[model samples]
Target: MREVEVSEITKEIAELCQEANFELGEDVINAFKDGLENDESPTAKAILEQLLENAKIAREDRVPMCQDTGFTVIFVELGQEVKLVGGDLEEAINEGVRQGYKEGYLRKSIVSHPLKRENTGDNTPAVIHTKIVPGDKIKITVAPKGGGSENMSEVRMMKPADGVEGVKDFVIERVKESGPNPCPPIVVGVGIGGTFEKCAYLAKKALLRPIGDESPHEDIAQLEKELLEEVNKLGIGPQGLGGRTTVLDVNVEIYGAHIASLPVAVNINCHAARHKETII
Candidate 1:
């Protein structure tokens, strides 16, 4: 069995937190570039260009792409063969978030309460999702989800008979309703099957996937392609102005559900889909 130090996890989480906020991933940048070239609307193309430029500057200067640095969302893939030493895993992750936000000059966006909201000054207590996998390496992915796109997300329980078409229609409808709100052209993550909450979790988890990658399942892959084409055709181009590309891509993730249920969830990522990952 492999023994790993919790302090290392903390440090890695801290760096991942800052890096995710500060830099746009390569796949995302390429998607924007492709959007700019393919977009027919002059206004939309210009907006995409600005976004590209902003990404370049952020990376060059080591600064966040957006002012709202977002809530630190961490996905941990722990190895069953490894044992954690030094501290509680969750606490270590939070400490990493605290230090990263403070050190990186990233904004603190988490709050203490929903109804009576108050800001958490240091952005501590990250939203951590841990899963045990058969391996010896611990993989961590940190994605800072901003409010703009996240607020526009939706969840629904469609009848099992609705099938693939049902999910496609629901997602496209949600994007249409959310036009210009979630900061198009955006990346749409569709979670199919699973329980209601599990569907939502999978949808959010799909956002952590590197942009431009297609779903592994052939059926889902076709759905993603169809959805991507349809969403871009909405003319809700960059920043909501009319254009040929409203969405950069659609990523669908599926899991098993009950015979009677088909839970669908939509998680949207803005043009600035900031994420970074590390293994330790």
Candidate 2:
């Protein structure tokens, strides 16, 4: 068995936290460029240009692109053969968040309690999702999710008879209602199947997939394409002013669900689309 130190995990998480905040993935940048060529609305094209400039500044300056540095969301694929050593894994992850936020000069937006409204001070107790996989290495991805887009997200528990059409209608309606709140030119993550909470997790996880990467399943890929077309037709535009570039991409992730239920979730991310990952 391979032994991996928790400190190593902490160190990597720290760097990822900062890197995710500062960088916009190439896929996202390319989508913005494509929007400029295809969005039609003059206003949409202008906004897209500004977004490109903002991304450039953030990367070169090594600073966060958005003021709301976001909740420190982490995804870890841990190899079962690798034994964790040196410290508690969760604590290590949290400590890494603390150091990363402080060192990176990122705003700490996490609250200690939902109703109490107390700030965590250092962005500790990150939202961590860990999975055990077959390999001997650990994969860690940090996705900093802003509140605006997150607030616009929703989950609908539908009867199995409702079917795919039901799911499609729900997603479109949610985006239409969201209208400018999640910040236009958004990336929509749709989760089909699974239990209610599991679908929600899947939706958030879906955002981590690179933009434009279609699912392997043909049926699922078709759904993603359809959703993107219908969503852009909404004419919400860039930043919701009005145009055809309302959505940059749609990513759908599915998991097995029970016979009686269909749980669907829609998670939205704004133009920043900040996420970074490392394997160790």
Candidate 3:
């Protein structure tokens, strides 16, 4: 078995938090460029250009692409053959987030409580999801999810009879209702099947997939394509000014569910899709 130190995890998470906030992924940049090329409206094209410029400036200046640095969401894949030492795993992760946000100059957006709202001061207590696997290597992914897009996300319990068409309709309606709130030219992550909570988690996880990558399943991939086409047809366009680039990509992740339940969740991400992954 391989031994991994908690200090290492903390150090990496700290760096990743800053990196993700500063460096926009190439896939996202390409999506915006493609959107600009295909968009018919001059206003939409201009908006896409500005988004691209913002990403470039963020990278060069080592600054956040968006003002909202977002809630730190960490995905960890722990290997059964590995051992962690030096500190509490969760605390290490939270410490990393604290240092990352503070040292990197990213905004501290986490609140200590829901109703009795107060800033957590350092963006501590990151939302961490851990999965056990067979290998000795651990994979860590940092995704900074902003509130504008996240607030627009939703889950619905649909009748089994609703089927694929109903699912498609629900997703489209949600996007329509969201309009420009989630920031248009968005990436839509749709999770179908599983329980309500599982479906929501699946949808959020789906956003981690690289933009334009299709699901391994052919039917699911086709559905993603259909959703993308239909969503763009809505003419919400870039920043909802009415154009042809309402969505950059549509990703659907599915899982097996009970015979009676058909739960679906939609997670939206704005053009500034920020995530970084490292394996150690």
Candidate 4:
């Protein structure tokens, strides 16, 4: 088995945390440019332009795109054949987040306790999800999720017979209820057919996929297309100022569920869907 150092993981996470906050993905930037070109509302078009400019400035200056530099969420794909050496994996990850947040000058938003409401000082105890895969390489993804869009996320346990129409209605309704609160022109991640908790996890994980990339399954891809069209029709526009670009994209992730249950979850990401990944 190959040996991997926990310190390396820490270093990688620190770099990823900084990079994700500073650089908006090319797919997101392109989406804004496309929105500017196609949106008919002058106000929406201006907003799109500003968004693009903000992204450029963030990258050039190595500064966060938004004031809320988000809670650090890391997705780790560890190779089964590789063994971690030197230290505890989770602790190493947390150390990385602490160093990253402090050194990068990103906002420290995590609280030490839920009810106590004390700050964590540095953003430690990052929300990490680890999976074992077949290869020898480790893949790490850092997605800094902001509170505004996350607050707009929802999950519902639906009857088995509720079906596709039910899901569409629920998602649209959630977006309608959210309105400008989650920030408009959002990316909607829909998870269907899983258990209550699994559905929520899937929805959050679905946001990692690039905006324009459709699911491999034809049915799911079609659903994503339909949802995107329906959501944009809401006239939420850029920053909810009223226009045809209500959502940048709709991504649907699905799994098999119990015969008696059909659970659905929706996770929303704002215009600055900041994430970065590295393989080691």
Candidate 5:
């Protein structure tokens, strides 16, 4: 068995939080370029250009790309063959978030309670999801989600008879209703199947996938393509001012479901699309 230090986890998470906030992945940058090239709206083209420039400036200046800086969501893949040493895993992860947000100068937006509305001071208590996998190495992904787009996300328990058309229609309407609220040129992450909360988790997890990558299953991939086409048809455009580049891409992930249940979820990410992963 392999022994991994918990301190290492803390150290990596800290760096990931800072890095994800400060940079945009190459795939996302390329998507913006492609959108700019294909979109006919002058306003959308200008917005895409500005997004590219904003990413460049964030990377060079080592500053956050968006002012929100977002809630810390950490996904951890723990290898079954590995044993953790030195400290408790959960505390280590939260410590990483606290240090990372403080040192990186990221804005602390997490509240202590839903109703009381007390500030958490430091961004501790990250929403962590851990999975047991085959190897000895641990993989951690840090995704910072802003409130605006998150507020626009939804979950619907659809009838199995409603089928794929029902799923597609719901997604399109959700985006249309969202309009500019979630910030335009958004990445749509759709999770179909699973239970109520599971599908919601799946939707959020789907956003971690790199933009432009399609589902391995042909049928699922086709659904993603169709959803993207229908969403762009909305003409919500960049920043929702009106244009053809409203949706950058649609990502879908599915799980097996029971006979009666067909749960669907849509998680939206703004133009920033900030997430970073590290394996240690």
Candidate 6:
């Protein structure tokens, strides 16, 4: 069996948090570039340009891409054959988040309570999701989600009979209602099937996918493509000033349903799609 140090995982998470905040991923940057090229509105083109320039400045200055910085969310895939040494895995992850947010000069956006809303100074206690995979390597992905787009997400339980059309309609309607709230030219992540919680999990997972990637199943892939076209047709444009670049992409992931239930979730991402991953 392979043995891995928990401290190493902690250290890697810290670095990833900092790196992800400071730099935009190549996939996301390219998405914006492509959006700009296809953007029909002058305002949207300008917004895309500004976004590109901001990314460049953030990297050059070693500063965060956005002031929000975002709440720390980590997805970990641990190998069943590996044993963790030296500490509790979850605690180590939290320590990494604390140190990363503090030392990296990233803003702390987590709160001790959702209703009372007490800011958790260190951005500690990251929202960690761990999965056991069939390998010896531990993979971790950090996605710092800001409030602007997150607040616009929605979830619903559609009747099994409602089918794909229902999902398309709901997502499009929600995006239209969301309009400029999600910062426009967004990335839409849809999760279909599974239970309520599982659907939400899938929705978030969908966001980690590279832009323009689709589900392997042909039907789902077509659904993703169709959703992308429909969302862009909303014309929310860049920063909601009206244009053809309302959505950079739409990603959908699905699982077998209960035979009686269909759960759907929508996770929206702003123009600043800040994420990074590391394996240790």
Q: How far is candidate 2 from the true structure (C-alpha RMSD, Å)?
A: 0.8
TM-score of 5: 0.98
* Candidate 4 stretches greater than 4 Å from native: none
Query: Where is the poorest 10-residue window by lDDT in model 2?
Result: 117-126
Instruction: Write model 5 residue lDDT over 1-280, tens digit each, in one string.
Output: 9999999999999999999999999988998999899999999999999999999999999999998989999999999999999999999999999999999999999889989988998877799999999989999999999999999999999999999999999999999999999988899999999999889998998898888899999999999999999999999999999889888889999999889999999999998888999989
In model 2, what lDDT does residue 141 have? Answer: 93
Candidate 6: tens digits of C-alpha lDDT, residues 1-280 = 8999899988999999999999888888898898889887899899999999999999999899899888788999998989999999999999999989988899988889989989889997698999999989999999998899999999899998998888899999989999999887788988998999999899999999988797999999999898888888878898899899888888898988998999999999887787888877
**Taking the tens digit of each residue's C-alpha lDDT, what string does model 4 give over 98-181?**
889888899999998989999988987689999999989999999999999999999999998889999999999998888888
How far residue 65's Cα lies from its native spot in candidate 4, in Å, is: 0.3
Clashes of each: 0, 0, 0, 0, 0, 0
Could you tell me the lDDT of residue 50 within candidate 1? 93
Off by over 4 Å in 2: none
Q: Top model by lDDT, which number?
A: 5
**Predicted structure 1: lDDT:** 0.88
Name the lDDT of candidate 4: 0.92
**After TM-score superposition, what is the CA distance of residue 78 in candidate 6 from its true location, in Å?**
0.3
Tens digit per residue, CA lDDT, model 2, 1-280? 8999999999998999999988889999999999999888999999999999999999999999898889999999999999999999999999999999999999999889999989989987799999999989999999999999999999999999999899899999989999999988999999988998999999998998888899999999999999999998998999999999998889999999999999999999998888989999
lDDT against the true structure, each candidate: 0.88, 0.93, 0.92, 0.92, 0.93, 0.90
TM-score of 6: 0.98
The alpha-carbon deviation from the true structure for residue 72 of candidate 2, after best TM-score superposition, in angstroms, is: 0.8
Clash list (residue pairs), candidate 3: none
In model 2, pairs of residues that clash are none
Candidate 1 backbone clash number: 0
Candidate 4 residue 175 C-alpha distance from true site, Å? 1.1
lDDT of 3: 0.92
TM-score of each: 0.98, 0.98, 0.99, 0.99, 0.98, 0.98
**209-247: candidate 1 lDDT, tens digit per residue:** 777788888888888889988887787888888998788
- Quote the lDDT for 228 in model 5: 94
Give me candidate 3's TM-score against the actual structure.
Answer: 0.99
